[model samples]
Target: MNKNLIIGQFTDAYLPITDGVVLTVKNYAHWIEKKYGKCIVICPSFPKFIDEDNFDIIRFFSIPMPLRPPYRMGIHYLDLKAIKRVEKIPFHIVHAHSPFSAGLFALETARKRKVPIVATFHTKYYDDFKSATKSDFLARIGVDIIVKFYEKVDQVWTVNSSTAKTLKEYGFKKEIEIIPNGTDIIPPENLEEYKEKINKIYNLSQDDNVFLYVGQLILHKNIKMLIESLYYLKMKGFSFKFLIVGTGKDEKYLKDLVRKLKLDKEVIFVGRIIDRELLKGFYARADLFLFPSLYDASPLVLQEAFALSCPSLLIKGSNASEGIIDGYNGFLSENNAISYANMIEKLIKNKPLLREVGKNAQKTLYRPWEKVIDEVVERYKELIFTYKKNF
Candidate 1:
């Protein structure tokens, strides 16, 4: 164990925003600081949002991105005070969670300090660029820039092998490391107590089938298809309560679609819950975790749901569905609303099978943050040693 290990985690999202990458960065900092050594989180500032964390955080100047609600574009160079504070820390190695502003800052800091820097390729940026710009040429240019950024880093990492394939498709030919994200949720001994609490809070009855989707409410996540699937399920006389957790830019559009599809009674948009305990309770109560994201590279929510013995339904070929064995540990569906609806109906019909699958999911997918960070710390040490030897 390195008692003097000092880490710097640079990310575009933090505290106020809840997403896969944000959760990954939070867990990395939390575990690293708790068991390893000191860690400093450098992220964009959210207006009037006071960070309440045990570890240190450096909030740089930023403005909210209009296209993506609650996600701010950080301008670290503009914050001279924050830069001075960052310069004072003797960081052993720096890790970047995004290739945007915060990542650029990490690259600069690593070069200035002459330390190893690791950048994790988490999102499908090309899809994001195409969705934002509506131009293939522009999206390609953006991807090229992203590849160049990863090339400069000491090491490149992805949450899974599927995501590494995506990075290679985008022109990053370097050897990529696979370090999966972790969850802190542990199944409670008295799970029914938490489930009962969730039932009362959500006005759900024990007999009603409960489906959950916990992540950003965006179109790219195929939330529209999830709602559409509910419509088909409702038409077949299947009574289920679908809880849509978290908020995003597409929330309003999704709500409007739900109303238009006459699924307002079946689907409930439960906005973002920052309380981890309450969130875990929802996972415990859910009969199935419904996630059909085509854009997510590696979803942290899937692991969080699996941690509480909740099986997830993901798209068959999606990057997040890499480890899942359809119907054995988790369920899979084609990229269509009817397939999702049919899959949901099939799973709910067999309660014993569903429960067994949930147990299997927990056994196979749940990886604690402590163990993950132990591996991360070892990797950091190896990177630092290799860099020093070559220097």
Candidate 2:
């Protein structure tokens, strides 16, 4: 895979900015072009996205990050059409996902072509700058600019080990690979026909349930205590259904706090789905997957709700409650809104313990996407054979 390798990816977000670091940089340029190679992303300037055909983006000058909406901020000057498109593509590695402004433009363009770069510290960016600049001295200067960008990355990833102990308590003295993030969401051997077609498209009657909550309704994704815990599970009467897919900037302050706690007919804001076979039939017709984020570090929608079997409840020490063990397989909460309305009113009065923890979280928690892109192409061939045997 190194022979034709051209890999390069930098990112202050991309593609109309849809998060999870633009779906992990388009699944690392779609499995690094099915292992043959050639990537090149470099991001930020999205004046209405255009380029679309197996990675090769590159835009530059950006701006609007005031109280962040779709997070713009990518202005590290020096353009010259991004230095003649990285001087006609020679990069062998320069991954980075964001240590701010495309990790200082891939460390000033891989220090003028000496190449060899790597980074993937996904989130908890100092608790996202103390919830977007509420300032603890600006989240300690964004954790001293991510410990000087993980001391100019040569290696540093984190998908678990509770985010490598929050990147060594945010000083990151390098060496931190964990790498576990992948989801194509495949768990459908006729799961009750996607729970009777999501209970006849959300009208619900087959003993109504659904409690979903895909991601980003903002407020650091605690999502205003998950819409005030559905107004305390609709004042405990609990006639289920809370489905809030996605779309951010806190949609009109969480739809005016569900009409000021009236919970407007047991909350239902089914916004963004992005059709992955109808978002895997709303994660196989969810029965509970709330996710009360206290600042995530490793959450790709909790492995797309454990690849469609949906069992998430997570909150006990966020980072998606690493390998959850609350009630086992999943269900942890304790972050708030009366502890996520007492864990969704005790799994809505235990529907057979939420279908035996969603069938042990999809047959005992899974992981694929070609074994997480084969540990990112064997850490990109051991960082391109130790950067060409020390240059």
**What value of lDDT does candidate 1 attain over all alpha carbons?**
0.91
Q: What is the lDDT of residue 20 in candidate 1?
A: 82
Per-model lDDT: 0.91, 0.78
Give the least accurate 10-residue stretch of model 1, judged by summed lDDT: 181-190
TM for every model, in the order presented, reads: 0.98, 0.36
lDDT of 1 at 311: 85
Indicate which candidate wins on TM-score. 1
Candidate 2 accuracy as lDDT: 0.78
Clashing pairs in 2: none
Worst window of 10 by summed lDDT in candidate 2? 75-84
Off by over 4 Å in 1: none
